[model samples]
Target: MAISYDNTGRGIKVLVNGVHMKTIPVLLLEAFKNHHGKIAFDKKRRITPEERKLLHSYLVYLKWIRKLRKTEKHLYQLIKDTYPVATRKVITLDSERFELVLDNNLKIKCPEKIYLLFTEKPVIIHSNY
Candidate 1:
């Protein structure tokens, strides 16, 4: 796990397995503030190649804009607010597949990369209230 501020000083670069995955902007870190406790990931087992790619794309979309799209925001809120009354609480977007487990903390646990990126240090939240 290697995360470093790029020489350009615009954002941080995340490298998984020594391969460049995403260069998350400084603003993106701030945008992640809302997801701190509401979302998490369980890395109890190995992450498959396809799952890694899926998570990579997801993060790309998440950091692309300052605010999350309404649909995306609603989706995550549902994951956070709902209880997993079923045996397996897995969620898949289109053809991509992944798993989500609502832990005792009530945080939705998905893939590790998403968890780590959002939980990265210096997550400053700017708000009026």
Candidate 2:
């Protein structure tokens, strides 16, 4: 997978297997006001580590969503509304793996890079929430 920031630096493009999958705005102001406590938005600066992790998790989730859409359209529709809205209970990242703990205590693991742009870095975590 490949990830790239838009020319305006306010959006991201996600590609899997060299195919574009999704694009989402950075929404720095909203993220700072809503999710990132004590963090400030800086258009002239690069994204922080936290933001990078968040983006990686989001891309993984999007990849899952696309797969579901192709294989199980009805199930995808049933869960789509809630999936993205599901709170992330925990997120861990490093150089070899990635893990996501969702609000329902379900965990997801990806040992390989889902986005080529973020190779080697791994994320892992557990959550009770």
Candidate 3:
């Protein structure tokens, strides 16, 4: 399924046995079903100011997370190629989170999107390759 956010044919594109049958995200269906077993979108010519604000906030958050994940995956892949291997885990505290991939001689810590606000610290280690 192709999940394209903010597109007309957006949501999870589903294929049944390798044939495109539905073009909606399956997870979206699950979300709607979980909330009330139905899809609830505020449909109106002009949304209320507050509603628009909330919608904007959600979309912005999604974009921020998507970009952050891309950055993280790229970095992780790079490190994985150079390093022997690592046990990966996520640590979340309050509004912040980080990924820790531990090898016998090293611990790789990658911060989340919110980590940019603080003073980031860099730790160097010697690796015998």
Worst 10 residues of 1 by lDDT: 32-41
Q: How close to the true structure is residue 79 of candidate 2, measured as C-alpha lDDT?
A: 55
**Candidate 3 deviant stretches above 4 angstroms:** 1-45, 74-129
Q: 1 or 3, which is superior by TM-score? A: 3
Comparing candidate 1 with candidate 2, which one achieves the higher TM-score?
A: 2
lDDT of 1: 0.39
Q: In model 1, how large is the Cα lDDT of residue 63?
A: 48
Q: Which 10-residue window in model 3 sums to the lowest lDDT?
A: 31-40
Task: Spell out the clash pairs found in candidate 1.
Answer: none
Question: Distance (Å) between predicted and true CA of 2, model 3?
Answer: 23
Candidate 3 residue lDDT tens string, 1-129 = 332223245454333345433334433443222222122233332334443333343344345446656777764454442322323334334332344333445545544432222213532333333
Error of 1 at 7 (Å): 5.8
- TM-score of each prediction: 0.22, 0.38, 0.26
Pitting candidate 1 against candidate 3, the one with the higher lDDT is 1
For model 1, what is the alpha-carbon lDDT of residue 29?
48
Total clashing residue pairs per candidate?
Answer: 0, 10, 3
